[model samples]
Target: MQRYFIAPEQFGEHTVMIDGEDAHHLLKVMRMKAGDEIIVCDGLGKSARAKLTLLQAGQAEADITEWLGASAEPLWKVTVAQSLPKGDKLETVIQKGTEVGAAAFIPFQSDRSIVQYDGKKEEKRRQRWSKIAKEAAEQAHREIIPHIGEVHSWKQLLQRMAEFDLVLFCYEKEGGAAGSGIADAARSFHRSRGESQEASILLVVGPEGGFTSQEAEQALAGGAQLAGLGKRILRTETAALVGLTCLMYESNEMGGA
Candidate 1:
């Protein structure tokens, strides 16, 4: 069934109200009518099955048939602090990263970063990235939409490192280090959190040209482990998704057969 994410206030005791763009999609694009069943998510991880009860003036209301279960969010949370890459790579990162269960994405300024944004341009870019994240979440059947953080300065990125229980820097130079592979690091994080109830991870990926030695050193000194993706170097766009996939797999979010 089609799923629509709405705020808590949109839902009454027995009915769910959907307005704005979603209503337009249902009424004008989907040509949905009364009695059609659709899934409604509260965006806080709650979902429900509802049947359309009314459609008027670009607004749609549905009667709640059943309240669904909690989210499919991973046992662990991952926030990717990616250095802004050239072109539309950031959008790709947000799109694929969301599918792989990343809890949030933060674009950061790195010494080697090629793209720069500020003022109105930055706001517009953020809006575009957020839209991509939301669409990807819906497509992937994710219970919660991954957050797209604002463009962060180098200082801000460093400051945010303290918030996570574990931090990893995807450094190509560390690829040959035994036991420091992305999968290994992720497994270690998972094991460390196994005894606990919740854990948050911060994975940092450099920009297109990669991080400078000084930058990597600073990150390492700030309690970030240099986790290697593989022997071969990966493009900036590919790194975050690969890291997120390894994390999700290690956390058992991607069921292993």
Candidate 2:
């Protein structure tokens, strides 16, 4: 069955009127008939099977049917505070990170960051990134779209560390006893019961060149654990995915695959 996205408000009165772009896709591109069945996700926690009851130029309605599923979300809220990288990599980071169940993505201006945005440019960039996150969530069959937070200064990133229960910094520059082995740390974080140090995992990843010693030190001093992902260094985009994947594995979302 074909699947489309709609807001929760469209679900009352035993019918949902598919409007805007979704109606355009159904009528023009797909040429769907009145009896055709399609699934609509509310992007909250509800998905339903419905057949087209009416199809018109200005209106398209689907009749009520059985629900496909309910409540698809992760256990914890994982937010990624990443230093904005150059090029189109930010789009990829937002998309893939959404797929792995990251609850939020914050673009931070850091010392080593190459690209910079301010005022109007920053707002436009954020709008585009939010759209990418929405599309990724629907593609991945996620129940809710991950949030794209406003771009903040590196100092803001350091100050906000206290809000999250677990703050982990993936900085390869930091070495020694402060480090926690990847797999074991993930296991420990996953197994944490009630209110452990990792009840709310907030991961921090740097830009293309990685975090400077000063930035890493500041974050560590602000209660962020400088955890090593592996021996080799990864690009800004690759590092986000790696960190998100590690969080998923640690949170037991990998599902034995």
Candidate 3:
């Protein structure tokens, strides 16, 4: 059965109204008809098995059959704070990061960032990344679509670091240090969580050229713990996905429902 995410308001007592792009996809692209079975999610960690009942007037309606409570979200919240990379690398990061269980993405400008997002281009890039995240979340059956934060400057990034409980800075030079690996840092954060308090982690990855010593110093000064991914140096695009995947796995996200 195909899956679609609908607004919470669209879900009534027994039926869900599907409209907009989802409706168009059903009516035109998928050629779905009445009696077809599909999964509809409310995008707030609620999903149900729905059977198509009506398709008309640029909309589709489905009756909820069974509610599914199983969630794929991790116990801990992770936000990928990625520095701007060249071309479409950041897009790839948002797409795959969503699939791997990142709660949000924050693109920041670093000292070594080769690409800069100015006025018109910034808005366009934000929209593009938001769309990519939405599509990726839908395809991956994620309960919530990961938020794409606005691009931030160096100072803004540092200021925003106060929001997360823990921040893991993926530093290339720090991988050789003892207990500086992502697993070690994640374990520490996971252990520090109190009753019913989920750990919120901000995993920071630098740009194509990586962060300068001064930039790394600032991030470390802003309460970010240096974490090395591995011995091998990964590209700017690979770092976020790898970091998120590892962190999720370490937090037992893969083992959970």
Model 3, position 150: C-alpha lDDT score: 87
Superposed by TM-score, candidate 2 places the C-alpha of residue 200 at a distance from the truth, in angstroms, of 2.9
CA-lDDT, candidates in order: 0.86, 0.80, 0.87
Q: Candidate 3: minimum summed lDDT over ten consecutive residues — where?
A: 189-198
Provide the clashing-pair count of each candidate structure: 0, 0, 0
Error of 2 at 119 (Å): 1.6
Clashes of 1: 0
For model 2, where is the 10-residue window of minimal lDDT?
174-183
Per-model TM-score, in order, reads 0.95, 0.88, 0.93
Cα lDDT of model 3 by residue, 108-195, tens digit: 9888889977877888888889888888988888888888988889899899889988989999988656788988887777667643
Task: Order the candidates by TM-score, highest first.
Answer: 1, 3, 2
Off by over 4 Å in 3: 194-197
Pairs clashing within candidate 2: none
lDDT of 2 at 80: 87
**The CA-based lDDT of model 3 is what?**
0.87
Off by over 4 Å in 2: 68-70, 174-179, 194-199
In model 3, what are the clashing residue pairs, if there are any?
none
